[model samples]
Target: MSKYDIALERIDAAHKDDPTTITINTTTLPYELHYAQQMTLYLERLDPNASELLRLAIRAQHLRRWEIPRSSYPATKIGYHSWRGALQREQAALVEKICVESGYTEAEAARIGALVRKADLRKGDPDTQTLEDVACLVFLDDQFDKFEKDLGDEDKIVDILRKTWGKMSEAGRSEALKIKLSERGECVGTEGFGWLSVK
Candidate 1:
């Protein structure tokens, strides 16, 4: 079974009737912001109001739970847990930015950030809830709102990966790359989101 399959199973067992799917709501967030584009697409199909932060947290939770590495998990959840402490630090700075931008006290912004992190870091919510999970979940949900309506035939599943294959979580993207290379005899040329093209 694939790495995604393991996470999927865990997610399924954890959120069986809890509605793990996210919905698309571009009014709140956008597709480009979601790091995991495809998974974001998946969530948006489920719920429009899905919070990106919550998604990130859950994914992080999953990673901690399964002990899956960045290379194995989908691109969205890669390095997710490792960046948690950094994300918290950045949010502290963001709180200051928000304070300056909104004319609020730095303390107030800090409080808000604290609440967000507290709520986001639900210990029992998932096995490895993370900030990246929240980011991707929210990002994907936002993107799905705009893109899902355009989806066509189910018979043809075409994944145009915009992220580096190496970063994909649960080896999703790498698995895809290997399959495509072996089946199509092509090699991907570059890195990041922009350089991908079937050869």
Candidate 2:
């Protein structure tokens, strides 16, 4: 959503270490290959709750390409658009599939899917409280290890969730428990992006 360097520098100063915010952050690392690594670090550092969701949404917004400026890309515009659509479907499908598996009504699943998509867009909007907002950031050093890694044992998710939640704000902690509960005592599958892990 940002085009200028000044705006990005401001965001970078705020969330450079928290890479999930890297997407909306118009900084030096915006186009870096290690962007995923930073993103994973940010997510792993935060629990999958409102605060984390807020960060995810910000990253998603950056990932969502409204249009690829012709100057920046001479060709492959159509292909890029198609690729973006594929990713969008993949994101929506994950929510829909999870909702259905959780026994959500058809209408409910649809609503949640829509909500999830909208949430992503919200992060890109300038008027909103960004992922860099103090509300979403709670510093707990070495707190990232609690969350399950893609290659980690799934059983570790439970302990990770517990430890991760412990590092969050009260509201974030509450939502973290809710997500784990929704998993039905199970763990989120470590597939695809796998919490945006770098390796």
Q: Considering every candidate listed, which one attains the maximal TM-score?
A: 2
In angstroms, what RMSD does candidate 2 have relative to the true structure?
A: 19.4
Query: Over the stretch 144-189, how does candidate 1's per-residue lDDT look in tens digits?
Result: 3234235532222124223323223432332333332221112212
- Residue-wise lDDT of candidate 2 within 1-199, one digit each (tens)? 3222332333333333433323344554433223423443445445344432344333433232323332343357686666655655654555455445545556655544444355343445321223322222321222233333443665565444444443444443432332322232232422321322211
Show where candidate 2 strays beyond 4 Å.
Answer: 1-75, 104-108, 115-199
Candidate 2 Cα lDDT to native: 0.38
Candidate 1: C-alpha RMSD to true structure equals 16.4
Question: Model 2: clashing residue pairs?
Answer: none
Error of 1 at 190 (Å): 36
Clashes (N, CA, C under 3 Å) per candidate: 35, 0
For model 1, the superposed segments whose C-alpha errors exceed 4 Å read: 1-79, 119-199
Whole-model lDDT values for every prediction: 0.36, 0.38
**Candidate maximizing lDDT:** 2
